[model samples]
Target: MDQVRVAVIGLGMGFSHARTLAAGRIAGGKLSAICDLNPAKQEEAKATLPSDVKIWNDADALIASGEIDAVIIATPHYAHPQVAIKCLSHGLHVLIEKPAGVYTKQVREMNLAAASSGKVFSIMYNQRCNPLYKKLRELIADGELGEIRRMNWIVTNWYRSQSYYDSGGWRATWGGEGGGVLINQSPHQLDLWQWTTGMMPKRIRAFCSFGKYRNIEVEDDVTAYAEYENGATAVFITTTGEAPGTNRYEVTGDRGKIVIEDGKLTFWRLRVPEPEFNQQYTGGFGEPECWKCDVPISGDNPQHSGIIQNFMDAIRQGTPLIAPGEEGIHGLTLSNAMHLSTWTDHWVDLPLDEDLYYELLQERIAQSSSQKTVREVGPVDMSKTFGTY
Candidate 1:
């Protein structure tokens, strides 16, 4: 198969994608073009390219270039759907950076665009590429964990400071980023949560704290509880303001519990209780140990590069995507549900009435007293053209 010519948008995270692709991490693909609004980024990228790469400041021009066969969009959360939809409409396979969209409607539109174009539409859920996670998912799928009862995702190591937020004016505001840790830093965790469990939250109740580090808006701390359809439950906790925080996920099932922390996957093997022991042990003040042991986890690949290569392989071989853009709706919906639950002081039910959520979101956006900030979209006046406020 010929090398798939791909163009990447947004120089921030997209730079790593470009570097990896150019370095041949994607065996059957090459980055033919790069787009960013920043002139210095364009100049720096151009200087770094291997002489034949094309750089453009306009995403539209890059999409219409006809030189690229696919597009990898690493722009902001809100921009992913718009750009990917455009590229898909132009018959380009798309790999969008996650959370997928700032809202559900956008994700639906992007999926429709992908379907109409009949091209690969995937999301950059790189964590799904982690071997530890792959093994964990395998065990869960094989019923190694039995019927999962509860799960907890405590991600605290994603520490962000005021300076991090200040690095880009658009980093923290509701309009710019849609949400904080959930959208920007925790898509990997959120995606993994749903991917491994094969469950979606039917209802969510959340509480959030804003502006602990910077003067910007959006929550830096969030604690949410979710209930699934099968009566299973999960707790998702995150904080961008914590230092040297904890990152741990524990899944408890009837057979055993699986714990993943600091890159180690440990499964506690449950002992089937003997009937004699169950009848005799009640006299004491203690209960029998239900499970024991921790499994050592070892094997990991370049996860981001792996996901990128997977996207390219799908393009070349017509293989099913590891994570489709449509599935992104779940994580995005979960995020919106959490935020909406917190904002409205009510439990947000799943299948989130998108219209109701959108109307509430519009009210929040209108009522938001946060100062506006804009990311430079090249030298063009984005004020009127982009309809960004």
Candidate 2:
């Protein structure tokens, strides 16, 4: 009971989690076990894993074995919720990767079990650990951007080739990963959109281009116009098809504007509120005075390793969770709404109808011709550590 024993399931992207725990980054935790279905992957894990690491072929057996106090679920999109439900049932703390699951209906089920289980449940939303984003969220919450007027995010730097899609049979497929850029590549941005702004879209008119730039069947490009509950309008644009792409997140309000890009947070503060300036000013050709400030960011952006350390801390130290597993539904719901908007060709409402979304997703799955080819995936790249809330 002195050391927190942890097991990471699904060795594809789970490799990073494994390596981090094996490195003894968390003073109270260590990589105790690993689970993967591929024999080839098992062999690959064996060579890199510590001498004391336990290996298992079946995830269900591994969860039920009671060999570890916590398990990080980095499996496929569809299996995320199911495996977490099982692990929580067996009294194991769970840290699941982003998007929770392919659909909200299933993710809701997982959330329900977590609510009843008295276990430490967290999500791998590592982007929340970024100091730049943390500052942005703090500014918005403090109303520095008074009466938020507009928000726009253009994150299109996720260029991927055919081999990347072919790297895994379950990737970018309707029945496999569910949706394309929206589901796979844009979850972090989507989560940050809602998380940083402290608002969810009331309605969304989304346009998603499926396979527009790739040979895959899921969306490669997406543009969405959203209206918040406070009557603020926002636009979100992302793609995996653009090279030398741009990542700009800006929000304009009555008092100030915040722009975050290239690892910097810039602020344009109005000397006078826009409404006050418009009402009191006699000039016809001028605007409010502004002060431009380059916000300085601090703290380490440990990302994936940061989330894992926090997860271990939550269990061992009773510290606060960075991203609770239950909150993941909001971002996934947003992603599903965008896809539903494209499917129905109209504006979709928030708190989306779960049954309707499930039915529509099933129809696409039934019609999809994409086949899944299960094979051994290699190690995780360094860029794979940036997903978050």
Best by lDDT: 2
Worst lDDT 10-window in candidate 2: 380-389
lDDT per residue as tens, model 2, 1-389: 46788998888789888998898877788999988877777887799889899988777677788788999998777777877888899999999998788889889989999999999999999999999999999998998888888999999999999899987766788877788998888899989988998889899999999999889989999999999877899999999988989999999999989999998999999999999999999978999999999998989899999899899989988989999999899899899999999999999998888888888887877767556421112222212221111
Q: What is the lDDT of residue 119 in candidate 2?
A: 93
Give per-residue lDDT, candidate 1, residue 52.
79
TM per candidate comes to 0.91, 0.94
Candidate 2, lDDT over the whole model:
0.86
In model 2, the Cα lDDT at residue 349 comes to 92
Off by over 4 Å in 1: 273-291, 367-389
TM-score of structure candidate 1: 0.91
TM-score of candidate 2 relative to the true fold: 0.94
Candidate 1: worst-modelled 10 consecutive residues by lDDT:
380-389
- C-alpha root-mean-square deviation, each candidate: 3.6, 5.0
